[model samples]
Target: MMKFFSPDMKCSALVILMINSFCVFSQIPHKFLYVVGCFENGTTEVQYEYDAEEMLYMDFDRDEVVYTVPTFLVDDPSKLFENLHIYLDAKKAKRSCKAIVVLCKEEEEDPTEESDPPESIIYPSEEVELGVENSLICFVNHFYPPEIKVTWTRNGLPVSEGASLSRYYPNNDQTFHQLSTLTFTPREGDIYSCTVEHMALDRPQTRIWEPDFSHDSSVGPDVYCGVGLAVGLLGVAAGTFLIVKGHHGR
Candidate 1:
């Protein structure tokens, strides 16, 4: 046989059960939708609804729905706003009509694992020309955690002016890439180095760039060859003139 409790006892028991459930639920990591609103009569109502378990956002007015979406993946966006009429009616009966809803999700760490030292390349801009103001870019790719320190040095002295580091961006494989640029006038024999420091490295990695000397090296040979060719043409012209003059004299 089942026993039925009095109305007052049943109400007390229900309240106690709700409180106990709230305590247990609060301990577990879960996403929630928090709603708060005020009515014209100056009464306020606050509600907390768990993600995937409840969809009571309709308790607030549409204008009051002003919260960031939860970070947790939504498996069913179609059902996100479903069953609103029931909650709206319940909220109306409770006299909590105007409200704002905000979705909150627990923060989770990034799933990508930490990686070894990042690969780096230091190069001047493609438009680099001699005696022109240009920038050198230090490209650091395939790194994890997105925490790195980039520094620049010119001719063994630290360069602080006109140096900037770009925001870390994610690569296709979930790794990160960052760029540091140094803007300066490229002078002859200037040695620039880009140094990268990260937790993955026992020592900082550095890449060096110097002005290309191939053009300068070829200039001497080119000038010598041109001068030799001109001298040979002059000798041939003199020989032809002598041959013409001798034939005329004969």
Candidate 2:
């Protein structure tokens, strides 16, 4: 029982089968790449859930597009957009459905404050004295590319002057580096802080230091805590003695 179909009919059946297969695969309409505008303090590229099915891409879409971004990522509370793809409807091949991964900026409540170590930075050992008598300058050094903007802030206010800044290439690390100096001044024992800012991030990385007038050299938290413990023990002993004397009198 060998019956041959007409050439026209055979061609029509093949075309229909191919259309059905396309609808099953590429036409399923699942999320591939997720794009986010900004993350926490120190993130270069916002990460998305790994999807083995589809290829991942940058902020931009399409099959082939590459972008260069700073190592550290964007800041918090940044205005962002969400993206996704939709496939052609199975029932209606002519119409393509748009599947939106709704702007979920507030969906899972975003995230808590990021608690990550800051970028690597080192200050020179030598301290530069400021003309403001008690003031001294400690610089923030950055060895990175893309030319990031540097700023000095005290108590969260923009600071100017009494700052030393420079950039150089010594063929040492084969990389460029920048140093931004800030004038740290405090009366007697007030705390002074140095903050380094990066354009790529929303918040600045900060380090705090307070001058100890009691010691000839600046004593930090460790030494101060020991002194506090000794004083606390003395107070407890004095209270115990007082309570004993009161009981004897009774």
Candidate 3:
């Protein structure tokens, strides 16, 4: 079913902007599902309607179809699954139905002395300083083969460009363990995550970071008092030595 379609090569920026406000209907349509845009807001204005001449997005407020997605056939199962996931996630978050989240699959790593797979790193996350831009991230991977692809993504979207990866092989073992490093910049309220998508797992495994949740900046005052006491004792010793030397001279 056509969720929406454009007509007469006319770009209606105003219509598109207006549709974005409805917040219930998805502008996305596919052959497998209706993928209707809806919310718990008690109105379903962005309903699906198909016309033979062209597919269109109708504005119930203006009583006219103003936009459309496209007309195409995509049969890949992975693509279909990704689409479904995006739609479901959008619905759950109450975000725009037109929002799309790209799905990523990790490449497997196999390493050997003669032929090392992609080097990968798996480590427990460290704590991120609050608002300091350093967030702790966790990753798990043992890439077996060489020339593996490594990427970091949040919410199934690419985060940054540069990533460093390494590999290690044991003396007796034949397979190599891979290591990968990516940025773990933490947001204030949101968590930073490291995901490993080895060819082994059907989906990537993600670990949420634990920031240092402590708000106390000062916790120790006894140590300061101890230092002050030591200084006082040293002063007393110096004064006694001076007094004894003066008395002996007299």
Candidate 4:
């Protein structure tokens, strides 16, 4: 006569004892039976189990041990252990390993196909002072599944030093984005590129950026202004020549 008690509940001792008694004689084989009662939107799980070592019925969950049967009531504990071993072997043969089940609100759908390739952009740091330490940023966005490989190169040679990649972040529409930056000093004619590889792309996507002295702010605006002045002078000279020739003919 095994006694069962709810370790957390004193008043539930009688209920646990009755349930354990029912479980002992229940025709359903313990090994094949799995009674899982879920509550609170599946956050709470209650599992009923049969313990072969103590030859007792038990119930437990994540928080605390719910109930256990006392040993005195179980007759022929050795026979119970034998039956449990046989049941375990049969279960292993049937499932081969653990099995999992997931419930979702939506209907189950097939696995997604490969998504579109990621969009990439490369740009130098805004501070354009020459001979200063700066970084080239590679922004890759709007990619699915979040797994990607980013690489950097300078002048067609692989650049590993001073290169870093940020963790993937989720986008508003459920896509993903990541950034890779390469730190380097700006120099004339240095070409840098960032390459991105993903499962959706047959070939790697690369974006290139280079420092151009012609586009330097200190010189670029002055050159454009000088060219505009020179054009204006030419136009004035042509107008004066035409007027003087008309006066001489008159």
Best by TM-score: 4
Off by over 4 Å in 1: 1-113, 216-250
lDDT (10s digit) by residue, model 1, range 132-159: 8888878787665456899999999999
TM-score of 4: 0.44
TM-score for predicted model 3 compared with the true structure:
0.30
Residue 32 of model 2 has an lDDT of 28
Clashing pairs in 2: 43-73, 44-72, 44-73, 75-202
Question: How many backbone clashes does every candidate have?
Answer: 0, 4, 30, 3
- Cα lDDT tens digits for candidate 3, 203-248: 6565544444564445224333433543343333221100000111
lDDT of 4 at 8: 23
User: Global CA lDDT of candidate 2, please?
Assistant: 0.31
TM per candidate: 0.42, 0.30, 0.30, 0.44
- TM-score of decoy 2: 0.30
Q: Can you write out model 4's per-residue Cα lDDT over 89-138, one digit (the tens) per residue?
A: 33332232112112211112322333547988776645545788887778
lDDT of 2 by residue, 76-152 (tens): 21222223321112212211111111221222233222111224232322232332344333333222222345555
Greater-TM-score candidate between 2 and 4: 4
Off by over 4 Å in 4: 1-109, 112-114, 215-250
Give the winner by TM-score: 1 or 3: 1
> Which stretches in model 3 have alpha-carbon errors above 4 Å?
1-127, 135-143, 146-148, 167-172, 210-212, 215-250
